[model samples]
Target chain A: MTFPADLVGLLALLGALFVLLGSLGIVKLSSYLLRLHAATKASTLGVGAILLASALHFSARDGGASLIEVLAAILLFATVPVSAQMLARAALHLHPDLAPPQPDSGSRQTVPEGAEVARPNHGNSAPADRL
Target chain B: MIAIAMFITGAAMLLAALRLLLGPTIEDRVLALDTLYVDALALLVLMGIALESRVYFETALVMAVLGFVATVAVAAYLRRGRIMP
Candidate 1:
């Protein structure tokens, strides 16, 4: 009906498209880790776009914009990555067979208990626990 | 336009449901559940826009918080073999 409305329509379409892609990815991806990569990254952007469109559409109202949608989006943004990593860790622990094999480097290094992977980017040490 | 977006979001939810049903592992099911949560929130926000109401946004916000907690708690249980660590 109006320019702003048209813009909101486009934003909604874009957001929904991203969300659909993310879902499809989870269904079609062969590996659990790959699916996590797809579901978290794409869905986060998708929901963010939708929330942005919602905020814009409600901004013209008498009470001003709705901040709830924006806050929800932020919460989604902040937590999805952590949840993904946690899920990955859990998956690895739960189904050790599902974890990908590590590249072979012919040197063994002992890792201290409770600190298998001290840091992700740490130099090559114990490749067995790199998952 | 909003109706079209709603349809698309609904389709996404369907696919997420499919994943939840047929996932090979617990982690896959959890990921699908997480995806469904976000898609549901998007639909809720769209409904708010279409209906010209702000109440749906509040509900979506609550859903977001609950979904995160569920995800984290489940992952924790899987990791430590217990819910509380």
Candidate 2:
């Protein structure tokens, strides 16, 4: 079973590029929460791409599909969002001031649970002062 | 081609490490560590492909599982001030 070297190379190159972008985002983003968003979202896709390239490469080289790479990818995909959510909550808990202001409208929907717990009076005041 | 990919992956890991070192808060450090592990996993997979070896794949799998568990545990600790409620 022979595979096109160029095709595999392309996948690997793209995967590496995305992974680099994600890490660069972590370094470049100003705030902790935005960095979390960047790392989790972009890096998950980046790892997925690399795993995909590996799966394709192995399946072609060995004449059979590689289940391990697929499983690893699935495990990563399943856990990233959960970890990101937990970390975001933790960040909010540790620093409620980092939470962005509620929309000008009366209703407040996106406030994190940790923010509510940490700053009960945060609802009435301006986040800028807190920051 | 694969060598270039490996080089890019290595650079990513270095950038993540820089964040881990210079991050102001615990949450930032944790986020940086998480990104580091994920990039490490990607690097392992790329290594497996480059070396035509199966062991790197298994190592990557183990790393993914461990990294997820560790991140969750740390996050839980940060949120509730305890690993277990």
Candidate 3:
């Protein structure tokens, strides 16, 4: 299938929006988990759109960069979630003082056996004191 | 077309940098880092095309690999304080 320039423009625009949302979400959200959700979901979509746009743009005139884009997209898709989840779990472990994420409404608010969000207070009265 | 695309992409890149600079937590910073990675990669690809240089090809590929590895490594470390525990 032949890719058109308009489609590339659309993809680039979509990618830009996705990125903007992710950054804004980082500032707007209150919790680490929510931040993870925002950044991972939004940035993934944003980068994916941009990469896809690049692929389409280049594939028409230069075929080589297209494959690199596919590779990059695959790496991005696989890595972001893994990293986000890992970081979230780690943050949960380190900063146990922070409140656990609020349970979703209408969902059975059952805590799994021994599953708890750790709340270790860093005891840092000064925010700059933390590692 | 080039100007418009570059402007949009540049705006996105700046937004991601904002997060990197001001994100409250380590995870947030990591997310910002990831965003920066993608943004930089996209910019590099565009640079390659603009310059018509295959050298950018290798550069982009190296960047892709490095970004993925770095994110994964950082994530694992954040999860457990060690990469292989």
Most DockQ-accurate candidate: 2
lDDT of 3: 0.70
Give TM per candidate: 0.85, 0.85, 0.71
Docking class of 1: medium
Model 2, residue A77: displacement in angstroms? 0.3
Those runs of model 3 whose alpha carbons end farther than 4 Å from true positions after fitting are A1-3, A62-65, A97-131, B48-57
Candidate 2 CAPRI level: medium
Q: Over the stretch A20-111, how does candidate 2's per-residue lDDT look in tens digits?
A: 99899999989888898889988898888888888888888888878888899889999999999999999999899889876543243456
Error of 1 at B26 (Å): 1.4
In candidate 2, position B6 carries an lDDT of 92
| lDDT, residue B40, candidate 3 | 74
Model 1 segments more than 4 A misplaced: A103-131
Candidate 1: tens digits of C-alpha lDDT, residues B1-85: 9999999999999999999999987888888999999999999999988998888877888888889899999999989988986
Fnat of each prediction? 0.90, 0.96, 0.40
The lDDT per prediction is 0.87, 0.87, 0.70
